[model samples]
Target: MTGTGLDDERAYLRECRAAIRRMAEGARLNVVIGERVAGDRYSAERLGYDLRSLAKELDEQPDGPPFFGRLDFGPGSAEHHGQRYYIGRRHVSGGPGRAPMVIDWRAPVSATFYRASARDPRGVSVRRRFGWSREPVALTGFEDEHLEAGQDLGVASRIVAAEIERPRVGPMRDIVATIQPEQDELVRAGLEGSICVQGAPGTGKTAVGLHRAAYLLYTHRQRLARGGVLILGPNQAFLGYVSAVLPALGEVDVEQTTVDRLLARGPLQGDDGEAAAAVKHDVRMAEVLRRALYRRVTAPPGPITVPDGSYRWRVGQEEFGAIVTAALREATPYGVGRERVLSRIVAVLLRRAEARGRSASAAWRRGMTRALSAHVDAVWPATQPEEVLAELLGDPASLAGAADGILTPGEQSAILWARPPRSFRSARWSAADAVLLDEVSGLLERPRGYGHIVVDEAQDLSAMQCRAVARRSEHGSITVLGDLAQGTTPWAARGWREHLSHLGKPEAELIALTTGFRVPAAVVTLANRLLEVLTVDVPRTRSFRADGRLRIRETSDLGPATVAAVRDALGHEGSIALIAADATLGPLAATLRAEGIEVATLDDIASAARVTAVPAAMAKGLEYDHVVVAEPAEIVEAEPRGLNRLYVVLTRAVSRLDVLHTRPLPAWLAPPAGVQG
Candidate 1:
């Protein structure tokens, strides 16, 4: 490229940036003016909020390129044919009369930048990618792939490779600049139907899910903003890791949280065995809770007697019992049905007042109904989720009655609290117990649902947990992202079908992302050994980069070996993670600290840190440029599906993986060094 061409590109970029700054300034002025001349308090507050959001959308990041790619379309193809469109994270307009300075990547016109290729140009004449410095101020270089010249382009784009191979420093960056055509399809998938993505490590599943949320929010802003979108990850650590992707992509309203946090009931205490937890998480538990809660609405002890003015209105026990039974049988929420039952009692009192030849005023009848509070309390008590769960777990007799056909005696016993608290307020609930409580709460009262939900790492969510999440999306859609082979939890999903079914999204389209872009070919090849043991059929993933290194080091001193590995990985360009069993994190961190090495744990948000010691269990949705696995054997022995855990640990590396093990590696991972098949 000539110097004049480079200078022209630089000049154009500056013009775009300037236009964005002007738009942001206009947004700020609108906020100020709207705040001062508001019609009312509510209007003022609403205008302030909307303008602030607009300003945020137009906010420029010093360290991010204003635009990453540009597409020049041919004549008669688009409304802006013969014009170039700069694709960016958000839309930036010059003014009402002038054309948009930059188009959001989610825009339909900008789709050509990602979907166009040498074979299928989609009427695109030229596609250009801009390379920026770390600070992203200067336009260092630009690469142009001309589609109209009939040039035979290669299989891969150098620009895309450079962007993908960029050394990431902070939390997971948005992949807007390097989204592949296949990924672009999923990201632009409509908001009407849910999508289930089964992607291997380095397949960009998490990134795709987040980007899809951004796209949905962009396309259906008013609809989604009203009900809102939610991104559910495995844990807070994972949530924190991917927190910036949406914001970076010009979306700031989506809620990111974990299943535990979403269910939000108890201080997660106590533990249950895998079997026990699975049993409790069974969908049948919903039925059991229903029976237990409805059982409380038994036959009224006696007829209700209401004294009105000078008359005593007496209703027979048979009539009251029949109404209570019919109300209980109604397919409605407990609270809703209870209200109907109260109305029925009111009707009975009104009829009795009419029969006594005494005219009762509306106010008088209401008073007579209110006077039957004692009777109503005894018949249909207001039951809370916690109170119902406590009684179900505390009273063995009640448990048996509810779980007769639903759960075996052993299963019931397993779920029963050993030392049941005196009340729901004092109950100590486990994570699984919290899920059960959420179920009962939903049954008693319909929980609020989101417009859309993105459930990353969905494979690890149990049936009941999925149901809890599904309840929140009952009227909306979801994006389910996970790799069945990476399911480390004991109750991990058996397949996408099972998971989708449990999530009440059986119609969701299952999309498989088999290309590994982050993990190197060698690392992915090494990790796929665990697939033989996993029952589900997971597609083999191919990596874009074949230069990733994988080495297994057998050492006597594992801690020192880990320290040495971390020291060596620090010499690399990207983030380094030292993954170990949960029990080994404390000692390993202490060892590294003793060695004068600054180490951050997974729980700590350490995006800037060059090195982090992450527990093997928490490494599911996280990635690193260089990963050092300390004692793979320990990770494999840590849980029931530890081999799957090992696979997850090994595939977290984007560039290199160093397996430092003092014990023998799992036999399924690889054969003995000297042995042949």
Candidate 2:
């Protein structure tokens, strides 16, 4: 098996598949094939015969008939129609090189199978004859099959299926099974009203999302042949990253994008959507309000409050600027009164909404009008009337448009949110495409112009953000994924469901992806250990032990013992990562660098490095070889923001772990004290 040739490999594969098929039949076991891009690879050999038996299945049949010799395109063939083509319901022609193409397994004449043309290969055409359709069935007995593989007069043969089956398994595995689940389950769940999967970090949230897409395509191949779903990835990198998952699962590719990309298409895309002028108008209003709030808050007698109570405070006015300059000169790490004033304005609008029979948004607009009228009367003594009103309610659209060209780097900070991209609009504004927002918790705002909504990483989203997501989709299902322990968003509060009432979503459908499939039991153990919250004054440590089997190793060092622990972990195989809470990034990075150890910032590592040090904040959505929590105490006491971050960092370690820290470890992190090696 070491260097088997292709034909030999094929024979071995055939034999193995036959054996697995027999085992599956005997056990009434369903097979879930993993990593199935090509049909040539073997089934399994490691992780014990029983576990491997359940790991995957390799079908002897090619992706299609054998006559075509596997029609899969080579890497990078997605462009030029060499590979990847979209098959819409009515034969939509041509798309990105990465789009999916339809392959017909059933044809009256094997050679007459139709494929969408490379460039508008509009109609079906006969290609070549395939062989497998005419081949006769080959049958064999289970004992004979096992004997052919030739186990020498073996010791009592292992009860490959019987002895290995565990009736009651950990809940996490159940979740993983459901997340991607078996194909039949996928078919059943796909058409079911709505589905929700709340996956924590390392829980394969994105993986399940991709699988779900494929499942829909495979089960409902006819309906999905046309565009039936939309995928919203977190960003472009993510779009490219998870693109292959669906195709691997035999799914027709659907649309994928970011929220900004979707918004561009929502109301701004066509005649049916909002006209560009109206969009521009809103842009202007946003700017006018921004400037009005800036000026109103910086006036001589402190800040000004409008009748409805919306107020503004300037961050860089001359007097306050001077105080900040003095403080910076004194190297003050802490500053006071940096409250975002416009948010207060929004809150005031909410308060006024309760007073008047109007929505908060409507009341806020009325309040702004009243505030401008009052500002005109008071400020007219010193300024011209036109200038006063103009400054108070500046033209935001013109300002925003101009920002595209003339604004300086510092002044153009808001430009990123200025406008939506154009491709996201529906051809018909009312079409409720099944919408999926991957890593939904991180979206900046609820996407506009969607009829239905689905979200992943719900736990990481703040309550307010979730509400925003709910507001964007009208009369559509909202599916979310999250893990309570991996709540990395600094602003996110636990129990995001509490805000579901505000968003108008049902609370009963909340789903949890509790399976620990991506990370081993050891990694989960380490993360849960550091994250064990106290209930009724008792440490919730026992909750960490999901199933006692550790597919991966777990390691740790209490506070004040990290440096030595780091030194020891460094001596092991594989790279290391040191995750910290504060500005300790640069210093510890430099320190580790001085020791000739590889160290990198979390942002940098997020983009490239496999094993490197990083701050907890930057380590979200990523993992590492051996992760070291530099200051668990700092995370617990001074920076609660880092607690979720620490959870993310610890889960990165697949085979090993090293949680280093200073000061005594918190009750959540203390190893069973003396119960050690």
Candidate 3:
């Protein structure tokens, strides 16, 4: 903490930065160099690609310092004796004696920096955390804890506390520099199995998921780089919020998308009622769709006879029926089973020809198989998934037969399209219909799975949506992240067991993040009150932070009061979000702009403004340092599951929350005072 110490740390930081720049220069100068590269296009192309990727990975962010912490080891120890390593977002080398100047945070040696304590130093003598300013990015100060000297500062280090309390103005930043011990465990967990995180708001569940992705990519780059990893968020806006996390960690291959976009079968021109959509998303619909698709395979019409050059091959109806029955019993994919039926039927004739001492060449077999196609198509008709789904929903007979005992008459009636289109290609598909079409598509042919998938806001996924995600991850592992209390959809899973069961990973470990460092005590308490009236069994979060402020004001005129609150919030040093119901958000934005306040929207995260007017529905998976909630009563009255929506709206504040209302506040909020009626 002295001036001399600051000067020494700054000098080391400058050296590390210079090493990074040199590494970047090396990657750029030596892109593609190999013997035989001139003749072999494949090798030249691959080397070119690998070099470009390397250069891009070495590119550091312009905001923060390369390394955030330094670890000094005790002498005569085993692994890191008499050595010190600066832990950073990326590796920096080319130091004196060809040593490492900065080690990547995902490396195995950096575990001690996060795991060591006074009781068990793990051979670590001291851990030093550096504080830096982004403007020109200079080393401002440093905090050190000497474990060998038995000096424990507090529950959290001063530098970490400062980082958590920093203002939020742009997109969500990565938590690499401030990851806690408990979160570090999850981030370093093995990549063989799946993990379900039941994290409350501000518990950093999303960040934990993203960091775990980076860790897996760092640890198992070769295994994962083949099939690739995927990240699924609730919406595009939420995706944009956390889009920069992996790239900042030197990972750029992971994909981020939504469930709706993943299962987009056709243009979404029609919509189903909530009841109808819920029924379509039920687990039993999987069986219903299967039954409707396989209805095309039935008993063989008659026997078949085929003629070749100077030979006639005949197959009996009994044998043909047995082949069809065997293919049906195989229970493979629809296309595979159909091909199995064709192969078996053709082989019977080939064997009979061989038994007669006849030579069947390759050309003869091809001709015979082609000739038998018309006969095979008659019994096992070729069908498309869209045509099957359209017919099943359009024709009452097909629906009743497929849903005879699986679905009730009322449930069957709910999903039937009232106005069926003339052609299957021209059908108006809803989002739910797209999921069903995806289900049928899988039944027709199994989908290719990814290497790993991290799905956020998973509590809001329905059974059908979970099934779709499961298919994409059938051959890989998954990291499921969600808060049960924040589930706002009508069909949201009330429990993790049912949700994981539908996702085909029922044995996945379910971990709860009960201690939060993101949301403050006041906001956690307010959100917990709403959890009581609802149906979540997860425990309330205990915020590790001590300084989350809450303010409530009642005024007859919401416009002036909201404008006044925004003006007051502008005095703070972070982003301000004025969240209200959909009906009130536009008028409130007008009021703020009419008063010469620059107000943007929450959906557009890149909008250049300090104050953003966010509708309560779109407030989930987002946070602001300061928040003003205008008319809590209206947020709870705008939707069917409004109280759940209100819970999501109340917990988005990271530093402070302001509630301004003209109507009475919800009784479930449990304010110290009674409602302002």
Candidate 4:
């Protein structure tokens, strides 16, 4: 293509941008005159919100282009035959009843843009990928792949390759332009089914999960809107890093949160040892909580008596027992069971009144319901989740009764509170305890459910955490994303089978994206050395990015070496991250600043500094173009799962990894073993 061709592509882009502006303008002009438009104030507010949401989607993207690729359909295709369509993150149309100027990448017709090949063109004549000037996006170039002979799938377009190998900066960006065919398959999978993507670093599993969420919302808008969609990340930082992906794809209704924040039911002023936390997060704890909660409900101790119409009616313990038994059988949450108990007792008294010719009106029922409150409380004492959890954790007697035959003696002691608080209000709880409270809350009162949940870094989720995620997805499905080999928590899943079983989605399809385009082949090979030692059986990932640089520097001074590496890394394009043990990060940051180098903390993704200092514990879901692993031994020795932690740290680099080790570098991995550079 010549300069004229480039100019033509730019013109098309301009048209698409203009179309979006007009659509937004039309939305802005749409006025809902309160009751006149929607008949009610609530409906009118809803109408206003919808209009604002639509307008926001069409607003200008300061730095990004509206569309990234284009597809020309063959004459043999369906309605779209012999037509050219621009593919973008969101749909942009001229007006009502008008064809879209830019079709959403999630649309069915746009699937060929990602999946077309010579062997299986899917009626695509030409697939074109656009290259943009990074950041404040401007069309720089474009490449075309005309499928005529054989599948050139193995040969990637230069534009796609450049986009894949492009330097990563700030927060993680949507990889819509370079989403591989394998990833697209997982992304476009049916919303009815859950998929567990077990992929190594740089496989774009996180992006696939986010895009799948956006796609599901686009395909099944009304269905998902009722139950809603949620994206759960390992930490708030991770959530922040990937927060823009969904909104960039024109989705704002979907929720992004952490498991801790989602399951926060306690004061959470407490801390727990890893062993204690592991015990609390065990699946057995669910049974323990259930038992503790239900034990308060028992057979009626005495007769139930109520006074009505100058007459007294008395019911025996035996008769009350029958009603209680039936109520227990039908009761789901504790509150429902209590209500049923009250209703049955009230019904018996009301039946006697009706036989005497007294009406069973609404007033009569309300009076009976209130009159039987004391008896109902006696039969089944009303309890809060905190009350149940506090008693179980603080009282040895309660713990023994609930955990009998469920948790071992050692496990019981591990979770036992040494000094109990005076009451539930004064109780201090750990994250594990908070999760337990959430479980108790579910058993007490049913929580709301979501249409779909995407849990990233799922391998680190404990049995109890999986259950929390599962409860939100009873009516919906889930998209589980993680690398089992990277599981670094004390209670991390040994395999996806166990993880999925805990999530209550044992039937979900498990997909592995072993071919990566983000991390370099050289970096992957070096990281693979640690995989052999992992308890789980994980396949080594192949990286199409064959040009990653790996440098090993063993220096006597750890701080000085890391500072030097960051200095050199600053000379490169894209973001640089210096990741090491959590304990060493403080001194390292101070040393870097002392040496006249400005260091950005991992939390500040938007920081202008070229280099960011990261702790290995916080590097699970982050990536950088240039990464400096300060000391492999320090990262591996900081925790019980240090080797896994080091694996995560080593794989954070997409373009370059410099291992600055004062001590040994994992002992097994030879220096510069697979350094392509």
RMSD of each: 2.8, 21.6, 2.3, 2.1
Cα lDDT listed for each candidate = 0.84, 0.40, 0.86, 0.85
Query: What does candidate 4's lDDT look like per residue over 1-677, in tens digits?
Result: 12237889888788877877787778777744332578777888888888877766666454477788887777656876778888988787857787788888999988888888888877777777788886577899877766644535433677878888888977888988888788889999998998999999989999999999999999999999789999999998798889888888888898899999998864578999877898998899999999999999888889988887788778889998888788778758889888887887887888888898987899988988888899889889999999999999999999999999998888899888999999988998889998899899989888899999999999999999998888899899999999988999998887898889889899999989898789998889888888888788889988988787898877899888887788888888998888888888889989999999988886675679987888889999998999988878888889999888888999999999898877766556667544421
TM-score of 2: 0.44
Worst 10 residues of 3 by lDDT: 668-677
Better of 1 and 2 by lDDT: 1
Clashes of 4: 0
Q: Which pairs, if any, clash in model 4?
A: none
TM-scores for every predicted model: 0.94, 0.44, 0.96, 0.96
User: Candidate 2 lDDT, tens digit per residue, 1-677?
Assistant: 02223454345335434543454453333322333332443543322333433333223222321112112222322333233221111111113352222232221111112222233222222111111211242211111011212321111212212111222111111121112222223223433345555555454565555555544554565654433566664445445545544443333346666544553323422231223222222223333322332232223233344454453522233443343234334421111111222333344446655666655566556666455444323421222222322232134553444444444433434322233334222122221111111112112122343433445445554443444455554345444545556565454436645545534565435455554444556556555665555111111222212322222212243332444545666665444567776665567666655666555543341433334655666555444445666665665554545556556666655445555544566566656433232
Question: Cα deviation in Å at residue 618, candidate 3?
Answer: 1.3
lDDT of 4 at 577: 85
Model 1 misplacement above 4 A: 1-4, 56-60, 76-78, 151-155, 273-275, 314-318, 348-362, 606-608, 671-677
lDDT of 1 by residue, 1-677 (tens): 12237888888877877887888889989988989999999999988999999887776444468789888877536675677888888777868898888899999988888888767777777788888777636788878788766542432767678778777676888999988889999999999999999999998999999999999998999998778999999998888889888888877888889998888775877688777788888889988988998888868899888776576778899998888888877878889888888888888877766787868788886786688767887988988998998899899999999889789888888888888887888777888888999999988889988999999999999889999998899999999999999887778887788789999999999999999888887777777777888777899888888677787878899888888888888888988888989888779888998998888877667445688989898888888888888887788889989888888888888888888877877676654353221
| Global lDDT of model 4 | 0.85
